[model samples]
Target chain A: MSEWSKNELGQYEYAGGKEDWEKVEQIASLCEKFVIDEEDELVSDEERSCYNCRFRRWTKSAFVCMRR
Target chain B: MKIFVGIDDSRRLDGGGAGEIVSLLTRTIDEKGWGKSAIPSRHRLYPHPDTGYRKHNTARSFSAEVKEQYMEELIDYACVMIKSNGTSDSNSGLAIAVPERMDNTDELIDYAYRTKETMINSDEALAMAKKPGLYIFELSGNGKGIIGALAAVGLRMTGNDGQFRGKLQLGTGEGYIATVKEIIEKSHIEQVKNMDFENLGTEESVRMGEKVKVVLLDHQYTLMVFPTDRQHPRWQTSTTNMLRIF
Candidate 1:
């Protein structure tokens, strides 16, 4: 699994690359609020994965998980 | 005649999403007998560093086969829908164009590609939308969305760029796995191919994957698949991450 880091705003950001399908699924498996985002935003093949989560906000480099 | 409808910046952080609004608008067009609309494609725009977009910097666009007589009504309805749905804080814009009447598609395409690489001003977008059959209108706020709105249509017309706004249902089966022929019969996707662009044979079975989406490639809704280590399901649907380069 990839390590999760925090931005200046304290939002949790995934350390793995955008296409890290395995790591994304591992994260989503532990979170109950993993809501699938719009099709355009989804990077992982797992439907319920955190990479597909609605609360995640995309940035230039990586995405930040908005769920508290 | 085909009418390309594009919309951007039509929602606030607490409000409805731009994609849902655009989907509703397309559904209304069909219900009102305005046209037979296809699925909307979501195009990404340049993200602002200072003022963040609630979601990603993405716009929605689609094409409809409508009669020429109802063209004016269509535009009017779209503008009203966008304005009414968006909050006072929204900086929304709507762009509509008839490809048959557009003479400067190459210029529009160039501008559309540039928007992805750098920031584009609304003035330049408005200038491009001033052609005979092209229409660009500001729905609310400062109307900077006109740039992304117009660019969405331009990218769509390129026969490449953007992903279909939603997932495709391949019917219930053993999880997400299905034969290439079965997928073709069940969905509107034009074809299925591997990452290398080689078309998958009809008899071949592949995993549809969760949240399956097709990208607009070569003017077709193509479901791109990638090879897997397992031989049973030799191919799997390409994820949005894989298709993001488009």
Candidate 2:
């Protein structure tokens, strides 16, 4: 169900842009490695969403999951 | 006296992000009765390819109203905190600006804007610190943090940059509607503006979203909105994607 592909930097970038709130929350719910980021860094309303994960590095368009 | 504190950290820094450090500093300031601090803002620097940090390229700053006699004590305490919190391999730095003591703040702001645009050298940050009105200190590592630290202070001074540290707890559920006036009183946000930066009238209604993030614009705490054309409310809180620009 995940559509992750390697970006030019060799990091796994999410196909979904930063606003896919529902999709990101679903992914984070099932992700075993999900860890909450600092309070100031949180973007998603869902505390457990991938957007709140500490391992996700923000890119210009989307974010790269560093867990892989 | 109004003073602004800016702090930056290297990617591999071990203790915490810049925001965490600022939060600790703010707490310390109030707990020690030095001064009252405001909410810290997170400023996004240009994500240049050459600058790979341990985390995101964001710095944190906050303004405080401290007593004149305790100013030196506050700065010294902040330096000590950064030293104890940062690891040996981490590069962390801070800049403290006293508006009254500094005359060349316009230059500092220009330097801050440039740091956000391109790669900056520490030497440039050091040179700028030599001028009056600003104090820059390198806490740890190779001292690569001066650029971001100075940029944080400058951007905070602009009164038009950075996102506030946390979201506003306006209401439960995302569909509740509130006018610009109501939201302002509830959230302490001074103004409501659309994505284009146009001011929303006091009577203008907005459908609140899950995350009610506030940004700094025109020297005010601003809540951003966009037209949704929904039946209940004509506007909705701007999504975080839209807020990435801050």
Candidate 3:
């Protein structure tokens, strides 16, 4: 949803930190391209969460969705 | 002689991960009789924006048993494997360390812990790589991956860090129950301990959780179980939430 905003680099970064599990899971659950990342890179307990999406890039505070 | 090999790749659109690359390297060495290698373990680094690898802040490493004469051959194979697999935009680095030749391993371990908490540059990593028994190389891109490659070897040296890249299939599936002895015999897990670090008896029952995984602890593949409400099988494999600590 609108929880994501584009930064100056024209990348869509999650508004909150990585701990916003509910939002990320909901977003990933809706996205058609939510491919699971490598098992080693997974952070969230949810298997299909955006935090586990291969296209999401981690920043200092939050993550940017490269697929966006 | 024993050696540790580590590699890091800063991949953006690449379909596969560096773990697969390093895992292939491990298998190749074993297949070639160059060494006997275990599965690769994955290490996490600081994800500070300044570090520049926003795609994935992770590295992979594995330990091997090899003859001292094969060190050069091993390094050459690693360089070729990494260079050939890396994408044009990927920045990859490889690090190999021989603990027997190092003057101080604790210092290297300290650097690994620091890399997990802060940003480290290529020059600093390269400087550390100049140690007597360590070798590091930047295969592509901006070469910042050397930081992670060096840190991964150090982290693996700690003997209590990182998780192996894949899962261990000891049981049929989730909710499968087995005793401590059975779990150990079925997989490479060396020890079965509860979350409190207490050792479980051979007869103690453990219920496999949604995912069965192991972590490197005390230089062994340790399967850590968590307490559950069930009485018959009170212990179960740890979940991903509980395992992210590694």
Candidate 4:
């Protein structure tokens, strides 16, 4: 597995300097943390923050962060 | 035969107010005569009934119902068209759009399951889809439209075990490049493993600002990207940037 650098918020950025990869991981993590594996089905701050992030945008049905 | 399109009111709103996008799409279809061969019908379901008490309480229920009806109509129309045409031709398609604000991902999953149930159990719709030439074009929205459609059609997210994933297909052109650049710049991030334009689809990984064409294929669906070099100033903000045929 490749190593990644985490920012102040515990968000991970890719070591190769690929921002889209970082964005994709951030989004995937957010989905895992807030949208998936929960009965309540609420969008948490981490997920919402991802939505507001530059690498990502919220879709009508899903949160679309960049993927490479 | 019929074609159905999902309309989300919020995204249609702008400085001029809501309904502009819908009007534009309707006009384009009308002018182009795309759906003229088969009758086109629309059903508008609000998040809340116009004259209901305590709109907040009924919002979820109302949205669910609207989505349910929309999916049912698409299935119904596809079945009719297939039976009449005797094949799963290009004409048998459904186009859908959703609002950006309705981002409850679980609700979308639920909606997909329900759609699957209806399709599996209905004799009429199922029989018509014997060949199952169904195409779903998810217009740009909050990304939920495509995600929901992908889930409804059973595309699981790979590598994450149970997690679901949806992919966006962009055409090779300046517009697509601009879109990628905006996504990267807005995302506040950097590099990707591969950058070759021709090898994009085959590459194991892609970068933030690469140009490529995407095709989605399955037994029942085919999504194709046709590149147009002309750029629209509003394409970035417009939800109609992408087209889905199902």
Candidate 5:
């Protein structure tokens, strides 16, 4: 389950809580992915994960997807 | 007089590039001082977040919006014309001419078939043609031929022959025949569907002395199919000389 909050627009929003964040950290640790140098132009592993995340799918061009 | 003209291009099966036809018609209408008219731009006037760029290409989704804009412009022009002429009925009518090609005939026919399949399909094409005093004519033939005829009449050709290559050129005479044939076929189907089979059986069987009303001018042909009964007022020769004077 995800944590929920209400914004000024009276719309419900969800975000990962401490428990969810911990789970994500554990998953990353198990994956053993190496972080690139801070100065490197290469995309971080975390950014790639964000691109493939279910949350991204929900947010991708939200207005267009809403019609479908 | 207030006239609303809707020009469609059926030169290609995918509803060929109508941009040129629309441009020519609107320019002609404006030049003649008949009244200001326009065909909607392919793209939406205002972009919506949801539609993005998709709304720009497909006429099916945007036809209503385009038509509405055209009508609004027409109404405005009509109001002006009325004020100046002191009468609203002074030769006022709508004329819609579509340039179609032989290759696209099957696609257009299929479109008509699908439209007939659905009960909700309003007979827009027929209704547009039947608008009281409005004259509507759909011109179709070999796309290249029609364009070639236009070129032959001294309208400059912009592209290479390969690019503009259309099938056979149906000169004025052949074009008239083809137009008449199309009108007859359309009328035959419509008449059979609306009228009793037995009543039309005699006429259908003989296929003799089957005459359709058509006028062949110097460079253009006009086919007028009465939407209502035989005695009803027919739409006049508005599109008769469209290509002739060009």
Candidate 6:
């Protein structure tokens, strides 16, 4: 969560690469707004992980969390 | 005849994804006896800036075999589905292509790849479809979805891109550890291979992890596994993070 930075788009982009499954899960566990995305967009098996959250839009190097 | 169906831009901020909608469409095709379809393949497009795309720009597509008479019926059904299901804020489009009718497939595939790098509009996509005698339809909203829908058919025809949506159940239940042979025999998965692209023997067993998904390789639904640790079931199903490269 500390690694997240707010982009000009106002979304919180994960500082970690797109594959940071553990970090995504750790952060998602502490947040109450995690909503799992559709199966095609999911990258983590941990259902509640940020990597699987619909609000997390993917970028070339990482992803941005759209939910505040 | 083999027909390819592609759909995109069906989700809005309210809630929905093109992949989920495509899966439901495929199921309906099967239930109605329209045709048997392969697993839906997700083809990603260029994430054009300010295009109103939610996350990444990706489209869902699948190939179905049906009688020549049912071709029009199938396309009509897909159009109706997209119109009824697409989110109000999104510009949904559907494309149906019969590759055999296309005079030049290389151009289509090249266009599909180009979409990954640049911004393309409906006019360009429409021109390409007209030249190939391909079918493209705008289901709702701004009609920009035609770009992804047409590109999806092209990329799928190439047989070299896209990750299959959802997991391929390797065992009777989720997370069931089973041998490679058992997995192949019991499920639709044709082969099991390691992450390094090495084939695992039939006797080798791997744990079906929570996300037991596959990618389209050599036109096969391949379940790729990786060695996570030195244990009895030394291998585990590859995660979406690993499969994302495809």
Give the CAPRI class of candidate 3.
Answer: medium
Q: lDDT by residue for model 3 over B154-234, one digit each (tens)?
A: 999999899987887766778789998998898898898887888889988898877777889899999999888878798
TM-score of 2: 0.84
CA lDDT of each candidate? Answer: 0.78, 0.82, 0.84, 0.26, 0.25, 0.79
Please give, for residues A1-68, the per-residue lDDT of candidate 6 as tens digits.
Answer: 57877766676667897667787789999988888777877666678898777776666557777677
Error of 4 at B139 (Å): 4.5
Highest lDDT against the true fold, candidate: 3
> lDDT (0-100) at residue A43 of candidate 6?
61
Leading candidate by DockQ: 3
Q: Report iRMS (Å) of candidate 1.
A: 2.8
Better of 1 and 4 by TM-score: 1
Q: Rank the candidates by DockQ, best first.
A: 3, 6, 1, 2, 4, 5
* DockQ, computed on Cα atoms, for candidate 6: 0.46
- Who is ahead in TM-score, 2 or 6? 6
Interface RMSD of 2: 3.2
Candidate 1, residue B7: how far the Cα is off, in Å: 0.7
> Which of the two, 1 or 2, has more TM-score?
2
lDDT of 5 by residue, B1-246 (tens): 232232222222112233444454455456655455422222101112211112111110001112323544543453343233222212112232222212222333233233212221124434433433323322332111111111111111111010011112222322232333333454322221111111122132111112222222221222322223323221111121121111
- The interface RMSD value for candidate 5 stands at 22.0
Per prediction, fnat is: 0.35, 0.25, 0.61, 0.00, 0.00, 0.43
Residue runs of model 4 more than 4 Å from their true location after superposition? A1-68, B10-18, B37-133, B138-142, B147-246
**Candidate 4 structure quality by residue, lDDT tens digits, A11-50:** 3433433223345446456453322211111123232334
* Number of the candidate with higher TM-score, 2 or 5: 2
Model 3's alpha-carbon lDDT is 0.84
Off by over 4 Å in 3: B50-53
TM-score of chain A of 6: 0.84
User: Residue A56 lDDT in model 1?
Assistant: 65
TM-score of chain B of 2: 0.94
